[model samples]
Target: MSVEIKISLNKGLYLKEPQDSKLGRKMIKHSIMLIEKFGFEAFTFKKLAKEINSTEASIYRYFENKHLLLLFLVNWYWEWVSYLITMNTMNVIDPKLKLKIIIHSFVAAHKENPNVEYVNESKLHNIVISEGMKAYHTKDVDSENSKGFFKSYKNLTTSVSKVISEVNPDFKYPYALATNLFEMSNNSIYFAQHLPKLTDISLKENKVVEVEDMLLYFTNKLLKK
Candidate 1:
């Protein structure tokens, strides 16, 4: 498959933009609504423009195509997740505690973003850390098809791994744990048929909090070993 990419490395982030800016906040917000309503594949410049009360040409002026729009949306999620982890775990001096907090945050966000793109976002981080992203962009790259779609995943792993190392001076296989965390969190929410539903609570309702509780429970249990 010929994958067409649409990211502007030079563009400002949507999360930080002013709400009323023409090609900034309002656009991002509306675009998200469009995605939430129809998913990323069904989202088109014509359809999104109609929903946002704008022209297709105007939408194109910001994003060249759906792929780029997807890249933008994926980047927004990573930035927001990174910001939340930093803000929430800043004061904790214990690396182990910080790791716990970070895991808590990841599980919470997984429950929060619950979509195909955010799932793609999970892959993106792994790719970034492994330099698989650069390979994807390379014309001479081999077996690029199996390389997966994550461009930001490596950074996510590095960040998470660093915290893991902090938690346990002897921690091995940080990336494996990162991968597991991503799979576990993502599966629990998005891939619901394979996941068992809750007893007295709904995973659909209070997702983040429930994920947080689960993460804390897992960490406390595992760390005791």
Candidate 2:
């Protein structure tokens, strides 16, 4: 039996929840595919509508605009990652082992989940690495931030930061280190694939062990007392 996981997101992100109906679910399924294939700059409601065999107006009924749709997808990824970390670390008594598990979860999040039929997590992960920053790197970020648009990402950071504090209560920058590790996991893979000179790991096939090794190496050295 495949258990469906429901991730509740901010209500303000969409005029209508995409998971509530067949059409809405189709919209999300095709949007992630289209965005991952063409990049966000070229993705629009018309393209999504055509890909899903729906009308542009129908997509607008669900999302206010493309940017909001992107935010919704990006936020969903953050919450998914947070869930992975929790599930992977559950009942693990050792803080060091838990942290290692957390790092592995971050790298392994790109793998497809059979439970989430609508969202192709591997493609969604590619979208996140390539386009996630645009969700918040905007002039209206302050306004959106005030509306709790970034709560998912912040909560994920806070949870990992707690684990870091457990590992070393005296560590001065637990939150910073937590966020850095998360960002580094994504950034390193992005660099390895596109800008090879910028990263030490080489992108060959779909394997990510080298990336995981590099992250663990950094984590061990930085947290060493």
Candidate 3:
């Protein structure tokens, strides 16, 4: 299947929809690069504005703060991931195979998308590994949750949990497993690259292959009757 370049994001993620305007698109595109380059702590609207040759005030018109911008970017990524999972597993009837396909698609998501010019999937994956959780780890998490700020992520988890149920109706931890599957996909990569001591996988080797193997092994081992 062809890679989709554009996906509609939740309105709650942004003060103004970046995908709606040329400058907004530049803000989103440059912000991804800047966040990946400097990490979320050092990334700012002023830095982003300089990178995009726009004013910080213009950027603020779209996002109330840098935290919200990160939320928007990270949520956009999760929605894309949710789409990829659905498209790839739609035709597969076997629950085990569907789970395997989900794992593989996630490993592949660490790579760049040639068709999507506005955002780099690979860089976005790094941001997710490093800073994605901060989006929800705020004092306003309850308020954001009430606003459906995490709907895309929850939808993805729910989708994966359904496959877990199909694989083993008696499994008591489908939601836990589903959410771990999502985090492990990125966390494993992060550990492999930055904290090799935390993981058995090595960055010198094909990290994606190692992560896929490890995920499949644990998943199959856990799900097997």
- Using TM-score, give the best candidate's number: 2
Instruction: Please provide TM-scores, in order, for all candidate models, with all chains considered together.
Output: 0.65, 0.98, 0.95
- The regions of model 1 sitting more than 4 angstroms off are 1-20, 109-152, 193-204, 216-225
User: Per-residue alpha-carbon lDDT of model 2 for 19-99, expressed as tens digits?
Assistant: 899999899889999999999999999999898888999999999999999999999999999998888788899999999
Clashes of each: 13, 0, 0
Candidate ranking under lDDT, highest first, comes to: 2, 3, 1
lDDT of 1 at 139: 58
The most accurate candidate by lDDT is 2
Regions of candidate 3 where Cα sits further than 4 Å from its true position: 1-5, 112-114
Better of 1 and 3 by TM-score: 3
Candidate 2, residue 189: how far the Cα is off, in Å: 0.7
Error of 3 at 74 (Å): 0.7
